[model samples]
Target: RLGELASLSYGLAMTVVAMKTVTPEPAESGALVARLETLSNAIERLPRVIPPRGKGEASAAPPPCDLQDQIAALTSQMEDVVAGGPIERREKAPEQAEKGEVKKKKGGFFVSGAFSDPAYSRFALKGTAAVMISYLTYTLLDWPGIHTAMLTCFIVSLTTVGETVQKLFLRIAGCLVGALLGIVSIVFILPDTTSITSLVVLVGLVTLPAAWIAVGKPTVSYIGFQIAFALYLCILQGAEPGFDLVVARDRVIGILFGDLVVYLIFTRIFPVSTLTQLRLDLDKLIRQCRDVVKTKAAFDPAAGAIQEAGRAYATLETASANLAAYGYETFHSGNRRLRAQANKLAIKALRGFVNALAVVAAFPPPQGDAEKSEALRQLLLHAEMNLQTLAFSLAAPFDVSSGALVDSMPPALSPDDEPSPQISALEALMARLNNVKMTLFHYRRLLHTEAGAYE
Candidate 1:
């Protein structure tokens, strides 16, 4: 307590010292102080008239325009003139009431809305239905292994109906192929073999081809996964004896049951097309390309642009291939082949554009070529603007009857001849930009031609 009191006293002394140090001297403040005193004396000298008293009468307020009243009235008029209007009025009770009111909040089962997103809701309902139906089918049929069917239903479920159906077909085919391969390996190659070496060889033979396929295309990767799964089921039933053919048979049946259930549920409700997904992916790709061009021209870091480019390229490629495959599998009206052809050509052009941009972006503009560099920058900016325009048009539905797609596009830039070392980078960048412009023109031309053909 003594220490606390000493600390408090020290703080008080320091505050007093600080106040003295910062305060203006009396000599410096004398004029302001004198003015304030003179104003007070003048205010006191102003006349104040007392009201006449009457017997049993209360004194009323002075008239509004007396010498004191006139000054007060003039001051109020001056204030209103300066404010440009009457003084603002406020109500205390309304403010107090607003402050006092407490907001009512929802509670209890209202928390369920958190999980009620439409996209995820569809996923949940579809998955539940698929699993329930699969399990019920196996139970009714008295299948030996119902677990595989339940598991396959979960594994084969995808974001869209088209993708799920595609994967289901691939998975079923892979299962049949894998089961046959496993059976051959067990019976013909190494009959009644219990040696670890033989088993390793068998597994390696089946897995190598499957892995190769799995690494090839994103659309067909599920086939490799299912193949490996089936091979494992058939070849690795138990350590006892050699192989179990019944396991493969049961798993194949389970897979078929799951696929059927998933297909029925997915096709009947909330089915999203592979083509629609492709367009969205293409939109993303174009936007990423725009960012790359704009950021590169601004001399900002290009790391994010490169990463986005890679991802968009991969996604676009996968979606394009899937759309083509899906189109072939299903019945599509209005010249499906022509649409696919146009889409494929556009994808090809986009790939060229991405590759050229990547190459140019890899090299920065050489120093000591300010004029050339500025020219290059302007060209890049111009190309970026054209790209944005093209992206916008591509996003919209085109009509041949309205006009050709090429008619609305920006004119392509022509590349100049080769240059010396000093301006070589600029020349090279310009050439790539020209190529990009030409590809875009070609892409638009293809779209126009296809549209005209369809019409």
Candidate 2:
């Protein structure tokens, strides 16, 4: 049965290939195409003939026409069709014409624009330097785990200076806790564990919490991994009755040195400022919001606008969180509070903007309602114009207090309809717009205050 099925499948597949590749228009006779198609249909309908499987049973006779021979003939005809056929010549004619006109550039090994982009190139150079320096330093010191030290550099480094510093502190603290745990485990618990079974079980048991913490908060995740590393280094090194504490010590030192190296490279050399990042992200969010509001309501929010809004929101949030780390800075510390407040307000405004876009997308323009339509258009225009001004303010330092009080206010988007559930969403959208205006007002005031103090 299997042999019969295999033959049928082969015949069916080749039949399809022949039908697609062979054309009768260029053939000498159209009857040949029709006969081939009929032969394919007959082959599909032919029943599988299974031979009896008793001892010394004779096999069934094969089909009258050899299927392989038929397939080979069809393949040869297809080759002929492709070699000198009018269709093949027509297809290649255009390519031959363009080949003389267009000169293709020679291909060679090279870097493209994507690799040269400042986003990647800046970090690529810095990170490579950190890794190379860490490895070289550890090699000079004759450390046991020089690879771990180099890996630690990458683990702690972040895009911004404040973030890198914050992670460095966490890495050091986590490594110390982990190293202490390793010491306790080796000294008290596994002192005489010659049995591999007992050692495996105990190691697994201790690794549970580290694994748990590793999956938790991003701030402390590295600590969990470090703890496991420290424990492994202490318990797994050396081939005696017990591993030495010196192995764990070396690893801890290497980690500390790696973190120090990364901090010096990332923080002191063209360090990224959280405030500058926040400003840039906020400007991007403002532009996306403006475009979303100006766009006509459709079945859904514009995908580009929504995507940009999401990225902008995430970047701003990250920058805001990193900026909080600088609150511990001794220089211009008073401004940190004002910066935090502005960040909080800006985040709120951004959330409101996203929600407003959602609402705009949910309910399209009210057709046949001229008054409501005109009011909505005017409101959107006013909001867009104000947002443009705010975006400019974020990009460049400017006196915010000089703007007219009335111009700073949000445009009224009050629905004409009476109170009902049908228009509750519309009402809420207007409220969110009002909240965004209030948040922007406070944000501007905070910026002005910070600027004045610096002056």
TM per model? 0.61, 0.60
Count of clashes, each model:
0, 0
For all predictions, the C-alpha RMSD in Å is: 25.4, 18.7
Model 2, 61-81: lDDT tens per residue?
332222233343443333222
Off by over 4 Å in 2: 1-125, 143-147, 192-197, 238-242, 296-345, 356-360, 364-368, 400-455
lDDT of each: 0.58, 0.57
TM-score of 1: 0.61
Quote the lDDT for 285 in model 2. Answer: 61
User: What's the CA error at residue 302 for candidate 1, in Å?
Assistant: 6.2
lDDT by residue (1-455, candidate 1, tens digit) is 22322322333333223223333231244543464455445444533432333333332334332122322332333323232333223222221123569445557863446576677788888899889888887788888564588988898788765577777888888888887887776567656565888778878988999999889777678788788888787778787434557776787778777878887777777765555666566667766667667765775433333444455567667756665545433533465565556556656666666655554343333346566556656756766776676677667665435332232222233366344321343344345444544554554554456432112
